[model samples]
Target chain A: MKILVGIKRVVDYNVRVRVLPDGSGVDIDGVKMSINPFDEIALEEALRIKEAGKAAEVIVISCGTDECQQQLRTALAMGADRAIQVKTGSALQPLSTAQALLRVIEREQPGLVILGKQAIDDDNSQTGQMLAALWNRPQATFASKLVFEGEKLTVTREVDAGLETIEVDLPAVVTVDLRLNEPRFVKLPDIMKAKRKPLDVIPLEELGASLASNLDITRYAAPPLRQKGIRVENAAQLVQELKNRGLL
Target chain B: MSKILIVAEHDGHTLNLSTAKCVSCAKAIGGDIDIAVLGQGHDAVGAQAAALAGVSRVLMISAAHLAHPLAANWAPEVLQLAANYTHVIGPSTTMGKDLMPRVAALVGVNQFSDVMEVLSPLSFRRPIYAGNAIIDVKAAEGQKIVMTVRTASWPATGSGGNAVVEQRTAQGTAAGHSRYLALNSAGSERPDLQGASKVVSGGRALGSAEGFALIYRLADKLGAGVGASRAAVDAGYVPSDMQVGQTGKIIAPDLYLAFGISGAIQHITGIKDSRTIVAVNKDAEAPIFEIADIGLVGDLFTVIPEIEALLG
Candidate 1:
């Protein structure tokens, strides 16, 4: 069985993102970029599945500008057997990205697919489910725990209500949540080895998937700022303040 | 003119408050709003939906497999009803996030998630970068729109107008590939975190799981819900469900209390909408103080017990 993992490059999670003054998008000028934290977790899970002998091959796929190949190489360093880059400069929305991934899924014919439940940048949480729908396969999302049994996969999801367990057949899509696993640190030796790994760059247009973006981002703005209040001397003052505000 | 269908989130007994919030979002979009209640033996939930102020009608869908709100079964059903409506909306809850994208894909439309403001029938404003920035977006014309409303951003519609309820069955069958096994939820008597008017959250400073007992005690005394920063949850002090951050539950409570939390931007995004925030951290320069309405520069170990005693 083969596992395909989707990785995305985004502004580092620690950076304070600022909207461009002209209301275009976030300013990423000179800022550090890293593989989306969740995507790393997904890739880590794929590596684990491969290490357990449940998967024969682990392939990492990323869609972005040529710059994204850096993140792909990092995935390869982390232990993905190979890397594929869908070259496109435009920001692909979840649906369009799913379509491109669907094309890859068809060509690769992987037994399982794994992706982050949502990207930290867009926070859409859509691609995995959309890909499953496009592929007409079962989807287990927000997976915190996964177990394989014969041809069936059991996934425990962390949902709004609580944890819900579900069973899905093979050839399914699983989107990982934060608690899934701690991604391993890429070693210096592995980084050198990753450079030798085969990386195939395919133009996004060559995939023959419709890349139309249905949602148009019109403008960007900062959220309303919360005004800071005065510091209290002690618990007595804190209680008094709450009582004065009728919050107690 | 647009016709909207809202997929109501409900347990078997009653509708979740998020459904009413979605109704508010739908009403703002200027549409003939109808709600589809899909569950087994949930007629009471349908009744609640009909009583929502702006709902014009309620479509009741009862299927044995839908009793637990599985996405594989619900998506196809939503896609079936979506053909008659121009927009299909659901709350950005666990069920909505799980189900709506599949419906959007099957219907060949892109999903707009966590819609905060309905700019027009076709445009919306949503938070990106974990609420660090907001993006205004417009859906392409001539395509049916599928979106999930950020329940925290919209107020629940009041009950007044009476909408007619109609029972309808979906033509699609449940996908046998996925099956529900069990749910392990923390049972609580206090208000749910998302809907809570007041919340008491702890951070990594709490140190250990046993330390969360103080947080619960404080929350119980205040009649508030309990929450935790991702740091606390990651440290094994609480379950993932208790995590309060951008990736966790986004809450807008009337009063928020933080103990030993050095506010990270991700955690701040979740609580920025809070009416009044109070922080107790020995480190006076903790980022939480920047947004806190009342900051107490003291050790939580001492401050929390003192406040609890004072309140008692």
Candidate 2:
């Protein structure tokens, strides 16, 4: 069995992303870019499944420009057997990205596909589910725990109401949540080895993936800012303030 | 003029407040709104949905597999009904975030999340980067707009009107491969964190699971929903259902009180929409103070008691 892990190159989670003053989009000028935090969790889970002998090979794939190969190398360093980079502009949305991955899925035919529930950048938690819809396969999303028994796979999903469990068959998509596992830190030795690993770059158009850019973003602006507040001296002052505001 | 179909969320008994919030968004878009309640034996839920002010009608869709809110089964049913509506929308809750995209894909269109403001039927503004920035998006002309409403940013439509309720059988069947096991959740008597007007959340500083008793006591007194930072949930101090963060519940309450939370950006994303924020962290320089409407550099343990006494 093979596990294809889908990852994305996104703005580092720690960096406070700023909107471009020109209203084009976010400013990524000289900003640190890395594998999305959730994508790393997905990769880590795929690696563990392979380490546990449930799978044979772990192939990490990313959809973006050549610059994304840098993150692919990072995934390779983190223990992916190889990497595939679908060449495309950086403006790809979740639907198109899912289509590109499906193209790769046709080429790889992995038994299981794992992706982060959402990209921290776009915050669109749609790809995994969209991919399953396009592939006509079962999707177990927001998975925190995954247990595979031969052809059957059980997933524990984290939901707003509470935790729910569901079982999906193989050749399915599983979007992981936070509690799945903590990603391991890439070591210096692994970085050197990753440089020697195979990395393939394919143009998205060659794979016959359609770019669905239907949502036209017209402007970018900051969210409403809160007015500077006063500091209360003590619990008594806080209580009085709450009363004045009628929040009490 | 637009015809909007709302995919209602429910527990087979009562309508989730999020459905009413979607009604608010659809009303803003200036449309004839009909809610589709897909579940098993959901007549009560159908009646509740039909009473919302802007709802024109409620469609009760029933099948044995519709009892669980699984996207695989529900999306196909929604797709079948999508022909009559120009826009199909749902709440941006876990269920919505999970289900809407599948429907959008099946319909061969792009889906929008967190539709904060409706500029026109096809254009709207939504938040990105964890609420740090907003984007104005416009769907292509003549394309069906499939979206999820940012329930936090919208007020629930009042329940005043009485609309007709109709029953229909689901054309979609359950997936052969996917089956729901059992859900493991401890039912809480407290108000749901997402819909509560006032939210009181604790952080890792609560120290232990037993220490959350203090937070529960305070929330009980104030009649607020209880939430926790991801740290507290990760530490097992509370269940993930009580978590409030970028990955958890994005809540907008009239009054939000963060006790001992250091205000990581992830945690701040969940509460940035709050009307008024109050912070009680011992650390004076906690990042939460930057956005807090009231900041008190004191121990939450001691301050909570004093505030409780004052309320008494």
Candidate 3:
């Protein structure tokens, strides 16, 4: 009856990212920020469930700096009843994010958890499963379709060859894929109403969880530029070059 | 003393191409390759994994309950299996995307997903900026190294004769947050886009979803899987499942035939590994021609029909 959705703040996909000159990180200046694209799908799925009367309550939760409150409000404006923000100045890896979400899970005890399959920034699609493991729950990741029947949840997953569907008991984690549904836009009236809704801000340390990264990023460097190609005059010359490169 | 764990992601019986590719990556990393198969009647899956070249053992976690892969359930077993293995690897499929990071978290490490090249046992290369740029990263901590392979670039191991299977128990987790309902397979005999050696893709320049469907016709003739650039997918010309790019699915088919696609860096990164790349773009200066083995400076509507007629 209780549904929880995980949202993340990421650099807007439209912006062209530039690597820092020092090769330490991406340049964050003047870049537009928004909720992760896939997370939007996750929030939309939860909203639909609530609209269908399948969920008694829907809560949007996010872990980021104070800036992430904007993303939480976006979710709430779309239809989430309330929002929970786990504030942290530093960026947390998927592992630490999962740990923090587990602390929230313990408190909220939601029967269903939905999250984006992967965040476009780090692209590490691990948090949902990690939280599921820590909570001893069953998880259906990358769901194209999800339906609840009795105490069972049926989920269709996108696999390499094709699609696959499975049913697991309730209290499971499901990650949303892009095809799940088109998220509804927040009208002006809903946005104004969401402003009046309750939004709670909690510090990560207050949750008694360590946001330390278990893995060290010793160094990050851009990949070498691809080799320049020889100018060709015709198909014959292309064939000659292919032969030279041993591609033929 | 550290064993290499290769996670098998399949429907249940047949082995997927990415599994074989991961085995090849595992061999390059140098370890006693062990397979972990989860599903009902994993006997065939275990045998298939064991038969692959360089596999030493196959760990079968057969359970009626595991007929489907639940990352929540699977991660805990991997955590337990980590006690026996030194390293773990899988293909960068949606399932791996969901499962690998959890295993890494359970073992208390940050997992590197969608790695394209293994520079060393500890160093790796992955695409960032939506595959517009590559980033080399080094994992300096954690006793176990966990990462997912980018599929097409890695060579798959040849079929082997037999393998040893050891059945293990699944950790029953009470938190059933999600469940498997039903499957609607794409139902194509052609190889999957991610694992195919030859890929034929279409773009929005073809004009409509029906135009994109031509890819299937060509792919069927060429015995290749259908692929599409993000432009085609985002334009609603094709299903998101058919997208081939950094934000979509990355592939390295042997022969890539791209029709009507201008080579965006993200789109190019997906097919850059193809041994022979042919691009048919009306725009002669399209970036795709930069890396293409064959460039047809003509309209795809004109060139594709000609190519299809030639093949016929």
Per-candidate TM-scores read: 0.98, 0.99, 0.88
RMSD of 1: 1.2
Where model 2 places Cα greater than 4 Å from the true spot, the runs are none
When summed lDDT is taken over every stretch of 10 residues in candidate 1 chain B, the lowest stretch is B169-178
Per-residue lDDT of model 3, residues B75-118, tens digit only? 77777787887788878887787778778877877777777777
Q: How well is each residue in A181-212 modelled by candidate 1, as lDDT tens digits? A: 99999999999999999999989899866756
lDDT of 2 by residue, B1-312 (tens): 899999999888889999999999999999799999999888999989989997788988989888888888888899999999999999999899989999999998889998999999999998888888899999988899999999888999999979889998888788787888888876888888988989999999999999999999999999999999999999999999899989999999999999999999999989988999999999999999999999999999899999899889
Report the lDDT tens digits of candidate 2 across residue range A138-169. 89999999999999899999988789999888
lDDT of 1 by residue, B200-309 (tens): 99999999999889999999999999999999999999999988888888888999999999999889988888889999998988999999988999999999999999
Name model 3 segments beyond 4 Å from true.
Answer: A188-194, A228-248, B119-123, B136-142, B159-179, B208-213, B230-240, B263-266, B283-294
Could you give the candidate ranking by lDDT, starting with the highest?
A: 1, 2, 3
What is the C-alpha local distance difference test score of candidate 2?
0.91
**Cα-based lDDT at residue B183, candidate 3:** 61
Put down candidate 3 lDDT per residue, A1-248, tens digits, no spaces. 88999999998977767777787777778799999989999999998898898998999999988889999988889999999999888788777788888889889989899999888777667788777766667778778898778888888877655677878787888888777889999888889899988899889898866645455554456555545444444445544554566644
Candidates in order have lDDT scores of 0.92, 0.91, 0.78
User: Chain A of model 3, TM-score against the native?
Assistant: 0.92
